[model samples]
Target: MESTAGRLTRKTAIISGAGSGIGAATAELFAREGASVVVTDKDGSSAASTAERIREEGGVAEPFTADVSDEAAVIELVAFTAQRFGGIDIVQNYASNRSLVPFDVAIAEADLSVWVQQLSVDLLGCVLTAKHALPHMVRAGSGSIVNVSSLGAWLSFESRPAYTTSKAAVIGLSKSLATEYGKQGIRCNVIAPGHIVSAGTENMYSDEQTEVMLDHVSAPRLGRPDDVALAALFLASPESSFINGQVIVVDGGMSAYAPMVPSFRRLAEAT
Candidate 1:
């Protein structure tokens, strides 16, 4: 077995949306690194399962069920975490309203409700989490907030206006938090992932779409949940103490250059 580094030793972390995918992966990784983790999600069973697995691995973790969109729920979640784990040293705002993707459409065709719902869970959730957690961190005079955004925030998608807009807002939120809290020792950063293979997003791209995506990516494979999880770990750890108000793109260089270059090269090669 490989030895654990204990990068987060003595730190207590609250990871929202940790029932599955990137959130779950990040929760597990944080535990292994020595943080006492509070794994939370709207799905009670899923949250419990992730916590159970962490415990099975001999790491300290507890599961809580709360909808991040609800301000009351978020307030209670933060209190519970602090009471259970002593204090909040780190917070990973990983919960997002991805189910609204189907309803998310172009601005002209977009439903008002869809935009509201998307922002409630994706953008407002992060705000609520930070709002309730910041005081705890401020009291401690040191903390880290890792908010998960999406590459869609930077790249233009065909549709899903609501999703992209909310994600882009999260980046702005993170930067604001870093600026306001830096003197108090709080650091805030973002992880913008691209085409990650995660729960509920496994079949996001069709076979043909996947091939086109691969051609644009610099890496050999699409991103995995662990790929983003590792990035979260870095921001959460003291290793990035000096890093704040930054956006770390976790894509396989997909957004690095012109999107059509890969297809142009392939066409030339075929000719």
Candidate 2:
């Protein structure tokens, strides 16, 4: 398929929050697939390390430091990529900054300042990146954008209203953009990953909590960062050209089943 035709050869991809987790994983994968990847994160050291690893793997990569929520920084990031790589064929917005505390506490106990900080980075961040990157893409008349949302967008959990709201909004935003830009040759999509195992998860779940979560998943094991990255690659590639304004849930069947924790032992015993 022409969609897979050189699979990113000579193409350029810009990913935000590439310092860790899904962002870092996607950056490495895109590089490996033959794209010149620009890795950006608020943490310079971590972003640099991600880029270095990609370089070690014979992939072309570079690191930059930027806060994706900042309008000026986002604009600069777009410009920098164009200057560095000549043009951008793919854009992935993966920067999110929010402490996963219970929402009720934040609403009742915390100040307004805290709320704004959460929305500014998580919800507004994706908007800002798309706003800045779209025009560059429109000028070229073709591009693909993959926005990283989360399973929280669809289902409710304890203590994370802000994060959930923000992620949910990303799906709506992507759909709106996709509708507006389809004629312009720019395809916008969302990838909602559920319960990925990473440093972030270590902070969010205890060992027991992780086990309970995995037991509920239809897939046998917890999702790795590479799993999400590979999905992003398909959406970003021409292989999925007809796909637009859609949210792909890569959650090991977590979203497909009931919300309660499952008992693997019980199922096995029945068998």
Candidate 3:
């Protein structure tokens, strides 16, 4: 059989939250594309499972456990990857504390804990990962860093104040990294995903919300993890070497239109 060479051949990638959802999908994709994938997640079993899946498909991968919210854990995670892989060429910050039930709370109803916890996972986590990973990338003189943000960063939804704020801060961080590290041969980018389907959202969507998504998104169907994975792949590879400090919104054109636009309204009742 002919070998399936890829853009990331011989590269090393460290992906956080790679046990499931977009993180898992990105890890699998990165491995398939020929990078040595370091998959980390809070759930040891899931992380192992993801790595095993990649290995089953003839990809190089290993599992690690880390809580992105904890500085010690994040530091250890990066150190472990550098030790295992010899160096780091790519880093994808895909970790977040995705709250299913208590995510959409108004500020007045939310406690300080909510803000702290959300910022810790959604924002500080990325900072910690990048802070550690950049040194390796700088030494190598070339590296790509991709951070996973959300569409909520730009658009206003129900009532996810904390989530929205944290995501918005991600955009700022991305730009700053691009500016400070561009001269160092390091590239930093952010991915803003739309309504991607995952285990967490398998049953989270209501009928009305589904209709809204269908209308808002330009793509005929909802988003899959593969969709986001493809974007991350581009950002991590040399194909996007010149693209830095940018937000690649993977929303299927959902965020491109206004709520009252005729096109959105047309799709709302097209069925």
Candidate 4:
């Protein structure tokens, strides 16, 4: 019997915001699956740490510090990846600005700077990354771009207007890329992840708040970074060759129905 090779064998991937959370997990998993990984982040030290861990685990990885909001930085990052790895096959756009939950407000009350900052990092960053990386993939004759959006893009939030807007825009941007590039052997897709337990999330929500949020999820537990990472792996691999211009929601079925109905039904049952 012949043995199966790793799904990503000979593939080279650049994963932005890979210093932690879903990005970090995806980076590591991609490496294990045989992709040469470029782990990049806005935080230099954090990027180095993630790269070092991948190296320790016997995976090929390199660390680069880049603020994706800056086109020059993204250009440099793409150039470096292609130069160091020979070409780019996969790009996971995951870098995002710090959570603006505290300051983000309804449009009527939102500051111009708030919208600018949020879109610069969340939306424009993905654009810049794709813009610079596309040529490399086109030249390679095949490539995959997996963009990380948010479930917030689908749900209306009383606050976080900027975040939701940016995320929703990502979906549109991805579809456009897929349409333009599919014939060129390039595919683009969006991953809209729901609430996941991560360092950033732990800082953002209290324990009580977490419990309340979990009640809305149909899954027995809240999502983990690996859950989304695994989804990314499949999308980025050859298995998804026919999957393009799609959005995969990895939210543990949180968005499947009216969350309040489930809680209200439980309350009625108890009564």
Assess each prediction's global lDDT (C-alpha) against the native.
0.92, 0.85, 0.88, 0.90
**Which residue pairs overlap in candidate 3's backbone?**
none
Location of the lowest summed lDDT over 10 successive residues in candidate 4? 1-10
Which segments of candidate 4 are over 4 A away from where they belong? Answer: 1-5
Which structure is stronger by TM-score: 1 or 4?
1
* TM agreement with the true structure for every prediction: 0.97, 0.92, 0.93, 0.95
lDDT of 2 at 26: 89
TM-score winner between candidates 1 and 3: 1
| Whole-model lDDT, model 1 | 0.92
Model 3, 88-158: lDDT tens digits are 99999888776724654988888878889888887898899899989999999999989888998988678
- Largest TM-score belongs to which candidate? 1
Q: Candidate 2 at residue 178, lDDT?
A: 97
Output the lDDT of residue 8, model 1.
94
Can you give the lDDT of residue 85 in candidate 2?
Answer: 90
Candidate 1 lDDT over residue span 1-271, tens digit each: 2325999999999999999999999999999999999999999999999999999999999999999999999999999999998899999988976687788888988889999998998899999999999999999999999998999997969988888989999999999999999999999999999888888586667889978778778899988999998999999999999999999999999898886787788899999
Worst 10 residues of 1 by lDDT: 1-10
- Candidate numbers, best lDDT first, in rank order: 1, 4, 3, 2
**Model 4 lDDT per residue over 80-184, tens place:** 999999999999988887667787887888888989998998899889999999999988889999999999998976789899999999999999999999999
